[model samples]
Target: MNRLLLYVHFNKEDSLSTHVIFQLQALRTIYSKIILISNSHLDRVSLDKLPYDIFLQRNNKGFDFAAWADGMRMVGFDELKEFDSVTIMNDTTFGPIFDFASVVDRMDSSESDFWGITNNRAHSADIGGQLRPLKEHIQSYFITFQQRVVAHLSFQYFWENVQSYDDVNQVILNYETAVTNYFIQEGFKYGVQFDTVSEDISNMQNSDFSIFGVKKLLEYRIPFVKIKAFIHNAEKPEINTIFDEIVSSSDYPSHLIVDHMTFADYPDRDYLLSQKTLDFSSLKGSRTRVGIHLHISCEDEIESFLSSFDQYLDNYDLYLTTSLEEVVASFDKKVKEVILVDRGINAILAWQKIQDRLVGYQIAGHFEESSFSDAIDSLLKPAKKIVAYATINEKIGLVVSDLTVSTRTEPIDEDSMWPYMAQLWNMIYPHNEKNLKKQDIYVRSATASFWYRPKALEKILSIDLNALVIQDLSAMATITHSFSNLLTYVAWANGFDFRFSQPHLLTGFEVRRRFESRPFLMVEEPAILQLKSSKAKRIIGYTIKRLKTIVKKLKY
Candidate 1:
């Protein structure tokens, strides 16, 4: 069967992503010809490397629908009409999870003039500048048209009249949803491979299936899943499980998903935070190459601060930075190195002076004067947890402490600092500033204390600290505030996972119990003993669950 595939792609980075490359490779098996249309800032060098028979590069004025129209126009109506089928798809989805050959083969046998993997059920929506009810239509993300539909003048007419719209809803309602309605009205039959109406309908919308019913879609062997599944609806526990489900069910490389999520904008920053956090409370001790870089400006708090971390000091080398001669004179024990910087140099500048020490260590921590004194006890568990996590998961490179771990009583007013941070971020990552803002990815350790891997500081270390602070103390403070929040973006931009450290959230007994339970399950023991332990755990869990239910009932 002769088939043509028009794939639209857009990336802020001006380069193709691993998943898109994988998708093109997969689609090559089923499509006779593939055209890659990009609405990104791809240069000729990047465009020349695209794995497609043809390429279309244009300004990103109108989103996917406009890209599709341009692709159709480039192909010309006469050439497009000759193909047995034409499939228009976009980079907004993750896969061809199941083989594209199988999907195409199944759809080939269908007699409908048009088909899609799924459909948006008839619903009310804003269209052409007003709210109105609309008929069901095939989603534009992936739709296949029979040769007859393409040859029809109506199809040509549709493309000829396509206009660029600034708003995406205008593109969706007027083009994506409207196209299907237009074709059906022209007497063409349409079919959907996975019909939402055939499934459970109570409180379920077909439009939400790509997100909420992704597991079910994979179960049914659908070829693609929306990327939005991972980007939005993060409040749902089901969203967190999508990654696991995809890995467990398909042969697709899981790293593609991980790499994308690291940079992709997730609206719910907390959800993304929860996704990447490492909690290795089960580990016995810190073994990974670890170092703590402490900057002491307050002479009075020096002894107390060191005393707070005394228990964990022996496990790792300690590096200190200070301008106070008294601090250098009085500090001793576990001191691997000490560097003197300008008296008023910010912690960031102090960190920069010792950037040469970042190598060889798998984990590095930063702390400024009095940053952890108020919450030292709360900081201990996370310090150990970060070490354990770094030892196991190399992907996680940065972990900032949660607000509860600091003396600050309110959320960081990031909006006030955004302008300053934006300037700093632009200086470091010029190409990514737009996306950084669009993703709303601001996160910071209010006290400027956090744990990070050495590699995550690669871009940050390149920053010109002297230039940043040459103006005045106000410039110094602005840069300091900006740098704290920008660290999260810096980690992510460098393909490292960023997480939050939740200190003091669990009691000592609870932490110990949680950690103990895992090893207890793993212990090599008699079959009877293991079974009894498992049973006891189940009974304990059930009893706790039931007591909570009873409490709720009594309160109600």
Candidate 2:
């Protein structure tokens, strides 16, 4: 009589229950006796559904490796001596009807050949060649599904020789690999039914039903089988639609109805706004203050502002008013203030109210007349006293210039190429006393070239200057002045003087020679040259002497 034993190992609950059920139902007609080998902790509901004849075990062994090998040994070829062959499987596998019969025939005909099966073609080469089947092998066992009698003898043979319980289990992988190699080395005939249709029970939705009837047979070696199965499926339309709606609603707050903005719907906004208020409370009475007002229309610009601001954490008392929560979250803990308003009417209305209270005039919708004059007047009263400006327009120059001129006792020497050092001084000290009869005391300097600002910095900051010059200049002026105040405060706290002074534009050679004591002949040589017909050398020599005399007077 011919009989068969099917073996399976299952790990997770979902696959253990639903997936394994489908495979068991499919295999019930072919194999004589079905055996399930698994861990004890499986869900009871899933376990109770199996047929009465199914063999079950609670593998309580300390090492899973040892238990698996012991489980194979317990299959007992002696009890099933009446059977002609047997089959082995894993929880993740499901085979076509012919798989069992074909594998058993191959083993019977080959006479003592070991057999293995796989659904992946890639694994065939791996098992045969580089895997050196005897060396590197996989322990996730799936082998013959065939006549019970011969299969029982092979399983019995494997069990008796099992050495160290752990090593025995581990050796299963090597055994499969070794058996594959043995076939090639000894010229033993091996057969693979690449056409066998088997679905990986692990993959449910896209089960491979094509090779459901063919079985791969190897005489002494394990045959590999390949099949395509679906592990993951694309999102269904309902879920995708809901996801898109949520994203759109969250991004366009102004378009959302007020009722839709409830805490349940917009949890992230609620959390961020609460955090902003808490942060604002921490800075109620700070001595010096810093604030960022981002009015950019694009998300990238807002992010860039926040990123650039983060680098100056130690230098500012930072505040932010923007729609970009991601950018704000990146700021340091000391940046303890922010105001949240929507990008539409709420932002404009809030600003209008602020302007009215501080500047004394309302911004009428009309652009024609000075309906907003009172607002500007009110703003000037408070703003003039406190606000300073800084700009990212030519940030490197501005930073380098600030570092240089703001140092009182130790002036930056001329060799430094801090960006816009010259321009920054011109802005900070608009009235150059040397050139001015009286200080002009301008509030802001005229806009100048930032051509030398690093392209890398500019890209990182995302500063766009393509708008009208006047508007761009005003915005940059506001930013630069605000930044300067922060810089001055930081500098002053560090024991460095923060007052601006005019930069020395003198060349290195001229600076060194300015105070050198020239011989009387050296001074007179230029005079003698002036008397001669040579104009160029005379001009240079005379200018050098005059500069030296000026230096001497300044020292005195």
Candidate lDDT scores, in order, read: 0.71, 0.32
List model 2 lDDT by residue over 40-150, tens digit each.
555667677664255556544423333445554566555555455455555533233124546555545654433444322213333223442233222234544233323
Model 1: number of backbone collisions: 0
- In candidate 2, which residue ranges exceed 4 Å CA deviation? 13-15, 60-75, 94-141, 145-155, 163-173, 179-190, 195-556
Indicate the residue-level lDDT of 71 in model 2. 50
- In angstroms, what RMSD does candidate 1 have relative to the true structure? 11.2
Measured on C-alpha atoms, candidate 2 has an lDDT of 0.32
Best by lDDT: 1
Say which candidate scores most in TM-score: 1
On a 0 to 100 scale, what is the lDDT of residue 523 in model 1?
31
Per-residue lDDT of candidate 1, residues 1-556 (tens digit): 9999999999987766778878888888888999889899777776665678888888898888888889998989899988999999999888877676876777778888989988767777655678877778887788899999999989899888899999887787788878898998899998888887456656544355776677678888787888787766544545545665676578987667666766676322332333343444554556555778888777776666667666654467778898877666677443777677788787788887887786668888887765675335434555675677666777677777654311343323345677777777788878764356522225566456878888987787778866767865666766676777677767777767766565544444553565465532233345325344534443344334323323333443
Task: Score residue 497 of candidate 1 by CA lDDT.
Answer: 73
